[model samples]
Target: MRLSIFAAALAAFALTANTADAQTRVTYKSAKSGSSYYQMGVQIAEAMKAAGDISVTIEESQGSVQNVMEAAVRGGDYVFTAPPALVGAARAGKGPFEARPSPKFAEIRALFPIPSLTMHFVARADEGIESLADLEGKTILLGKGSFGADEGAKYMTLFGLDGKVTVADAELSNAVGALKNGQIDAFVTAGSFPAPNVIEAAAGTGVTVISLTDEQVAETGRARLVIPAGTYAGQDSDIVTTSLPVVAYTSTAMDDDTAYALTKTFWEQKAALGEAARWWNGVDAALLDNITGQIHPGALKYYDEAGIAVPDTAR
Candidate 1:
């Protein structure tokens, strides 16, 4: 009798173990540790966990360029975020990916639109900073090895403030405290609006979000963005800037059902996500117009069921 009871208990344990192993597991790769994108990844993982039987592991990355480069080795259940332009560049074997083209680039597919990368040229308001040209003569921290650093540097050069400004080599995580302590006069960070660092800076100290003129905005050739007044503490008027449309993506290796479940959960929980953070509100079906590559069949299925039309360019 004792032996029969022990065998039955062992069988029950095996079934329980198998049941626990059935959850779908995915790896979500986003930006560095302190970034808003990284925080979003954490929130997404939690939301997906609560929604159903799925497990998402959050991974830190240097930037979108690195994320795209790794897609070849990390196909199945690997989700990464990048601007649509980067996706196009990777597919064309141009830009950063030009060094070595991979056929895997052909397998890249859009999962969903997250948020556009909005440019914020934050400065000390007490210093009377006002425009892109004002950035000249200021010390700015644009962090190394990041899309923001590269884009910020490019903008400075494009707007003709490159040589005039002193670019600090500090990591972006230190940007707020550096600005608060007067260690740096300003910093240029790129992320969705109401960027966490920007909010902290504004609340911690007197700061100004430099507004680009129509001509400056035109010269950059990025999408126009207006930061509504009161989005932060010290701002009283609209601040116009530019943005690069960003999207979450995966490869053909991720099975259709896994991709489908991920997409469905994202859309279904987006509203609640937005209620918790305004940045999520920036994403919408209309933003699909900015996508440059094919949409995952699983994600497309969800879009069709919801009546969201994806543009032909992304088909």
Candidate 2:
């Protein structure tokens, strides 16, 4: 009897040690520090860490494009980025990924979608730039080495402004200065409503928030969004524009069980997370429609068990 008791205790100790060792540690790559996306990433990491099954760390990055590339290269276990940006990079193998095509991009899978980010076109009110058409034959500032540049280039092409407007690449602050000094007529950017830079620019100078017409939105294949009146100073009316869905993704390197656990933990604790950040309130299983990449099998399994329909494309 004494020997059996001792043996049982030893087996229990080994089981506990093995269970602890099995906990997966993963690093989540987020956007620049102090940004909304970064805060969301922090909350997600905290949630996963609290689950007692996974250990998580957050790493700040330049932006969506950088996050996607880093996650694809094994630099991060998961990444947060705009779905359109990742889809575009993977499909064309151009832009920031121009040097070499990343066929591995196909292996990247979507996990969840955050709130949509609206595309904002800010132009000098004094420059007679009232609408997207006014941007023609003008010099525009697109963010240097970021998705803004890619979107700007695409917008110009879709709107038939290519060759009519000269595209200048610059950081947001520099671009604001150029607009103030009359160096650039307009600038293109995308983010959550009431973006700080747009607010600052509106406070400093008279500017018009250009809206895309319905036709333009359809042609661009972007969702239509409206920035409510008074979202920013000097903006007295609603601004109509297009939006892109931001999403969290992981590569195939993440095993099915780990992915399922992470996905289940996230959804199960989503209400708590939403309380942590208002933006998280927008995260729902329904928004998974915006995910353009393949869905991780683990996530699909979770949704399947929950009876949530998984799109054929994602599967």
Candidate 3:
């Protein structure tokens, strides 16, 4: 009897040790080039580590679509992505996933909401193009492959801009260069408040950012977003334009207990998570309510504990 009791205690110790180590080994996958997005992931990882003995790692990922697939396949543990890409992946049933159609769609859940991305129409000071309609006959560089490009394409189709907006597809870096060289009348990109590229390009070039006006803002809200004053390139200045809201998405492959623990830790250490990245500014405990789609049980539990009401749809 004494020997059996000693053996049981030894096994329990090993199990406890394994559980503790599991929390320390949290890993995430994100894009290296997108500083803002990647920074958030790092912050989450750090917060997780600081909450316990967890060691967090962030690996370079392809893009939004790729990241989602990685998380679905368990190739990665966590991921951040825009809404459209996440939705598209959940429907396709492939990529970083094994599910044919709904693979991990229901399992993945929202972790955080990011600032809206402004889709700016940048024109040369002398171009005389006032509205998106004015670029009918002029050459325009719509951001390519990037989210901005994909959104722009959708906007053109939605607004019936087929013949009215003759846009040339080019990589963001190349497009910026082309715009500087007068190869394209305008360079467009969907980005966060104070887009680094636009600000950098406009520093000395005298570029102008156009707004969607009240009507346009409402119209674009159908597929994208538009932030109010003081959210753009200038501080203490009003910038009225349409944007695309970004959300941080994580995989559903995480076991319920692990996800629950991390979710609980995240809320408990919310301050640390926000301090980890610039994009997290203004994020409040309530903003978690703004999310669409399914909510992970762990997140739901955390929110419940905080007295935050979870929508029936999310459940």
Candidate 4:
């Protein structure tokens, strides 16, 4: 009887050890510290902890380009975020990826999309600023050292409005007040849809978000995004804009089970994630069409079971 009891205790102890050893660990590399994407890493780490036994460690990266470069040699358990375009560039050995072409670039597989960087051009509707051309005679604010400023300046030059429109020299922090008081005719900002600054500007003044025409979008050679109607106050129509898709990816070195669990947990917790941060609300399975590489076999399993269609290129 004592032997039987001893055997049962040994079995129980073994099970406990096995369970403890089952935890999966992943290293997630993304943007530089203090950026919104970096904060997303912290949020994702917390979500994984709350969901199950998986553990995620956040690592800071210079940017997406660096992320793709590192994936060339990083082994299993390494995950990172980057725009799908970079993956394509890496595969073709063009652009920044031209310097180094590794077969490992071919092994990169997509997991899922996070929030994108969407452009928003807030303009005073009362000033007859309904389109890009309308900005030709308007005074606009393009905050210094920002994506919006740079892009706005480029578009003005591209569309022949550079010398026509006057740029206000003001900090972005005061953009809303300046717009409300008519100090500036419009201002350009880029971020995820439902951008807070745009929201505040819309509510405070009769402002409209600019929609880039198909011709203009194509000319600019950037991805397109359409913000649904009713996304903001005083905006009753779709706002077409530019989008830079950000994606999560891993190398084939990671086994199917670990990738599957990670992908499954993400989709399952996406709603909760959106509740935590509004930017997450912009993510949807449809964005998978933008992923450049094939989907991870493990992540594909969850997509199939969940009835989410996979793009042929991604499969």
TM-score of each: 0.85, 0.68, 0.70, 0.87
Full ranking by TM-score = 4, 1, 3, 2
lDDT of 4 by residue, 1-315 (tens): 999999999999999989878988899999889778898888898888899989999999988888999998798999999888888899899999888888889899999898888878889879878889989878899898866778878888989996898899998778999999989999988777678888898887978888989888889888878898888898889988887788999999999998999999998898999898877888898898888779999999999999999898788
Per-residue lDDT tens digits for candidate 1, residues 1-315, read 999999999999999989889999999999999878899999899889989878999999999999999997885989999988898889999999999789998899999988788889999888888987887798999998766788898998898886899988789999999998898999988889878889999999989999999888888888777888998898999999988988889999998999899999998999989988999887888888888889999999889899999998776
- Give the number of the best model, judged by lDDT: 1
Q: Report the alpha-carbon TM-score of model 4 versus the true structure.
A: 0.87
Sorted on lDDT, highest at the top, how do the candidates line up? 1, 4, 2, 3
Off by over 4 Å in 4: 1-20, 170-174
Higher-lDDT candidate of 3 and 4: 4
Clashing pairs in 1: none
Write one digit per residue (lDDT tens) for candidate 3, span 238-298.
Answer: 4466655566666665555666676677667776654554445545454445567777676
Give the Cα error of residue 203 in candidate 1, in Å. 1.5
CA deviation > 4 Å runs, candidate 2: 1-23, 31-39, 50-53, 60-106, 115-117, 124-130, 135-140, 160-170, 175-185, 202-207, 223-238, 267-286, 304-309
TM-score of 3: 0.70
Candidate 4 lDDT score at position 1: 100
